[model samples]
Structures are given as structure tokens and as C-alpha cells.
Target: MKKGLIRTMLSAVLGLACAFAFAGEVQVAVAANFTAPVQAIAADFEKDTGNKVVASYGATGQFYAQIKNGAPFEVFLAADDTTPAKLETEGMTVPGSRFTYATGALALWSAKDGYVDANGDVLKKNGFTHLAIANPKAAPYGLAATQALDKLGLTQAVSSKIVEGQNISQAQQFVATGNAELGFVALSQIYRNGKITSGSAWIVPASLHEPIKQDAVILQKGKDNPVAKQFTDYLKGPKAAAVIKSFGYQL
Candidate 1:
């Protein structure tokens, strides 16, 4: 009996050692719009796989620049499909590692109630003193917002009143903090539980702008990293898909 007990304890120790040997960390660069969902997904992934994810959130364009300069991210979740595809072409990422993870929706939002109408006529009414948006050059949401404005013929009219944020999160902050009357932001930032939590918002129609197809790719540095590949696969699984949908993004 003593011999059997000793063997059992040795097996347990070996199992624990194996688990530790396989565990690893994946460094992720996530787009600001995906922050909440990605964090939740990462937590779920760690719980299930015993691996760790260290994520940094920022504008996709900025992440692109950093990746070009050899940032040590294993995976990149971009806010648009174009950037990832561009990286793949430039040899910064594993060829064919790119895939659309989510299609984001944009909303014109205000921190105050009754400011925005259901049809988004607020843009035409020109009742607000300042309008906030992410920098079109840096953020996909900003580019979408610009496209929507141009489609509505409000680009020139609202040009002087525009306030630019560094990213979508900051643009939402501009409205939330009263820095601007209203701004275009990612729907995920202002939505939860199938409803808008605060203020008024107009969900921009998909027809107004090009689809914001958010994509993910394994960077060249992570080509052989098992944890990185697993994280990317986890993102396409049901658990991660559900979490992403909860954040107002369409998969």
C-alpha cells in the first residue's frame, strides 16, 4: 500500500510538471474598440487552457507602426481587415494567418438624453456646437464616420465644428465628458446587454459606410508560438464569439 501511494504522488507531481512545462504567455495587440470583449475572452482562455495573455490596446494604425518597428506582440487584433492584410503582404505576419474576427458597427452618440434622434437627423439639424470623431487617418471607426458624413453631405458643413480624438475610446470620452456635444464611436463602447446604457445614440446603417471587418493575425515573431495559435483559434470558438456579440460586434 505504501508503494502504491508513493507512485500516485509521483504521478501527480509529474502531471503538474507537465502542465507547467506546456504553459506559456501570448502577447497580444488589440484594437481599442475590442478592449472589453478581448479582455473577457482572454480571461476565459486563460481559465480553460492554463495559458496567459498579455494584451495591449490601442489604435490599429499605431499598432501597425509599432509592429513594423519590431514590437514584440505575438498576435494582433486590428480594427480593420485592411491593416492585417497589409501586414501579411509586408511579411510582418504569417502568410494566410489573417481572418475576420468581427464586423464592428458605428454609432453617433451623445452623453445627454434627447440629443440624437432615431433617424440620426442630429447631423443635419446642426444643433450641437461641437462634433467629435476619431482621427480619420488613425482609426477605422473614424474613417467610417467620415464616410458616413460624406454620404450625408455633412462633411463640409460640420468641418469647422469637428473635434478629433486619438481613437474611438477617446472620441466616446469626448462626448461622455462634454468635450464635444456628440461623436462617432464604436457601438461596443456604448452598448451592453442589448441596450444603450446611457445617453442617446443612432446606430449608423451599414449602407452608410464600408463594412468594418476587424481581423486578427499571428505576427512573424509568433509564427511558432503554440499559445499564440491557440488564442487565435479560441477567438473563433463559440465562447469568444458569444462574448464578442455581447459587445455589439457582429461576427
Candidate 2:
């Protein structure tokens, strides 16, 4: 029995070796809010399929412009489903290769512990001088933040103190670096395993904003690339789903 098990293990190693021998890279355009989970998923994907991922992270609208202009990205992971649908309508993606990968949530976060209350009452208190947000024109999270403020009847009060970032990552940076006392950010940026990872945050109620259904698609540039399709398939698998959930994204 020991010898039989040894042979099985050796054969598995050889099979993985063969898979790696033909490994190639796929370029992916990823929305900034997905950075952490995607990094974890990509590592698992490479281990499982022997394909290298070259990922570029940025705003969905920015990625949209790049993809439309013939960027080398083979796959797109957008912050909102509409952007992927837009690309499909524009003939920039492979037909029937798009699907929603994750649902995102927003949070009002402060780098200082205990600054943001559990119910997010600080926004109405108007105690903070600066509030960072992603650019609403380019980021879905920013639009959600705006919508939440509108719902709370604080849009006019918050607008004057708003500081905008080109992407969600930069918006988080503003709070982390103390450029802003507190700001709206992707919940995935600071949450893990059903809890906030650092500082303080209030996960915004979903009713305040439209659903953030993030989508993934194989771009037209990857129509002939097997790895691009493989990556997209892997993203929908249980392993990737676990990572996404760990980062506060809903699958």
C-alpha cells in the first residue's frame, strides 16, 4: 500500500510538472477594490493551473478607456457590472464570457481607532475636516458613497469637505496617511473574516446605495488565449470564492 501511494504521489508531481512546462501569462485589468483578494486568488490559481497572472489595478472607468483603446489586458475584472456590459456592447469582450464575480460593500473608515461609530453617526456630526472618496465619475464605490450621503441628507454638508481619489486604493490611502480624518472606502479594503481588519469602520447599509455587482470577462484581446478563459473559470471556483468572502466581498 505504501509503494502504491508513493507512485500516485509521484505521478501527480509529474503531471503538475508537465502543466508548468506549458505555462503562459495572462494580463488582467483588475478594479482597485479587489486588489487583496485577487492577489490571494492569483497565487492559488498559479499553483493549481501553472498560469502566471499579470494584473493591473485601477478604476473601472479608467480600465474601460484603456481597454477601448486597445490595452494589452486580456481579462477585465470591473468594479461594476455595467462597465463589463458596456464593454460587451462595444464589442471589446469575448461573447458569452462575462459574469458577475463578486458583490461589493462600502464603509466609512478612519485610520484612528474608535473614531467611527458602529452606526456611522459621525458623518452627521460633521466633526471631521476632510473626507476622502474615490472619484464618482470614474469609480462605482464613489457613486455609492455619494448616494449614501444623499440618503442621509448630508450631501451638501459633505461636499465641501470631500477629497477625491483616482481610485479606491488611493481613497483608502488618504485615510491611512492622515490626509483625511475619515472617508468612504470599499469594505473589502479593511475587512476580513467577518470583522474589520484595522482602525475603525461602519459597514454602510446596502439600502442606501445601488448594488455593486462586480463582473469579470475575457476581453477581445484574449479571444484566442486559453489562459484568459482558464483564469476567469478559476475565479468562479470555490477556492476563489473563499478568498473573495474573506475580504468582505459577497459571491
Candidate 3:
């Protein structure tokens, strides 16, 4: 009886050790525009899977350059599909690992009440002195903002008044802090529960620019890491989708 009991305890210790060996932490590079949703999703992922997620948020373009220089991120969630596709072609990411996770929307927003009109006519009226947008070179939202401006024939008219942010979050901060009067930002930043939570905003029409199809992929460094693949899968699962949609992104 004593021998059998000792064997049972030994087996339990071995099983626990194996479980610990299989569980791991993943380093994820996430786009700035996905800040809110990714935070919530990461928390949920940790709770559900007993795995740790270390996230770094920044412009997708910046992340792209860093990844090329051998950044240690195991997973990358980009603000645009193009970067992931480029990485795949460049052999920087695992082939067949890329997938569109969300479709982001752009918005024209102001901190002051009634500063923006429903039809976005405020741009034509030139009511605001400064307009903030992300840097087109680094942020997909910035590119969309420029495309919308070009489509509206306001690129030249408002070019001088434009203030550039390094990322969508910073662009939103410019408006939120009243630094630029109004700015283009990701809808996710200022929206929740099917309503604009603070200030005024105009959701940019999809016709104004190319679709902001945000994509995620496992980097080559993570191709063999099970936890990295699990985290990527979590982003596509129903629970994460709910959190994403709550932030105003389309799945």
C-alpha cells in the first residue's frame, strides 16, 4: 500500500512538470489602433489558457521594420493586411499563417461638442484650424485619412493645416487633448457599444478609401511555438471576436 501511494505521487509530479513545460509565453507585436481590444483579449487569453502574452503596441510599419531587423516578437497583428503579406513574401513569417482578423474604420472626431457635423461637411467649411492624422508612411489609418481627403478634393486645401501623429492612438490624443481641434482616428478609439462615447465623430465612408483589413500572422520565430499559434487562434475565436466588435471593428 505504501509503495503504490508513492508511485501515484511520483506520477502526479511528472504530469505537472510536463504541463509546465508545455505552457509558454508569447511576445506579440500589436498595432496601436488595436489597443483596447487587444488588451481585453490578451487578458482573456491568459485566463483561459494559462499562457502569458507580452504585447508591444506601435505603428504597423514600425513593427514591420523591426521584425525585418530580427525583433523577437512571435506574433504580429498589423493595422493593414499589406504588411503581413509583404512579410510572407519576404520569408519573414510562416507561410499560410497570415489571416485578416479585423476590418477597421476611420473617423473624423473632435473633443468639443458640435464641432463636427453629421455629413462631415466641417472639412469643407474649414471650421477647424488644425486637423490631425497619423503619418501616412507609418499608419494605415493615416493612409485612409489621406485617401478620404483626396476623394473629397480637400487634400490641397487642408494640406497645410494637417498635423501628423506617429500612430492612430496619437492622432486621437491630438483631438482628445484639443491640440489639433479635430483629427482622423480609428473608430475603435472613440467608439463603444454602438455609440460614440465621447465628443463628436463622423465615421468615414468605406467608399472614401481602401478597406482597412487588419491582419495577423505567426512570425518565423514563432512557427514552431505552440503558444504563439494558440494565441493567433484565440484572436479568431468567438470570444475575441465579441471583444473586437465591441470596440467597433468588423470581423
Best by TM-score: 2
Q: Please, what is the TM-score per model?
A: 0.93, 0.94, 0.92
lDDT of 1 by residue, 1-251 (tens): 99999999999999988987888999999999999989899999988888999999889999999999989999999999999999998889988789999999999999999899999999999988999999889899999999999999999999999999888888888999998989999999989879998999999999999999999999999998999999999999999999999989998
Listed per candidate, the RMSD to the true structure in angstroms reads: 2.2, 2.2, 3.3
- Sort by TM-score, top down from the best: 2, 1, 3
What's the TM for model 2?
A: 0.94
Runs of candidate 1 exceeding 4 Å displacement: 1-22
Compared with the true structure, the alpha-carbon lDDT of candidate 2 equals 0.95
Please identify model 3 stretches exceeding 4 Å from their true place. 1-22
Full-model lDDT for every candidate: 0.93, 0.95, 0.94
Worst 10 residues of 1 by lDDT: 14-23
Name the TM-score of candidate 1. Answer: 0.93
lDDT of candidate 3 over 1-251, digit per residue (tens): 99999999999999877876777899999999999999999999988887889999999999999999999999999999999999999999988989999999999999988888899999999867899999999999999999999999999999999999999889989899889999999999999989998989899999999999999999999988899999999999999999999999999
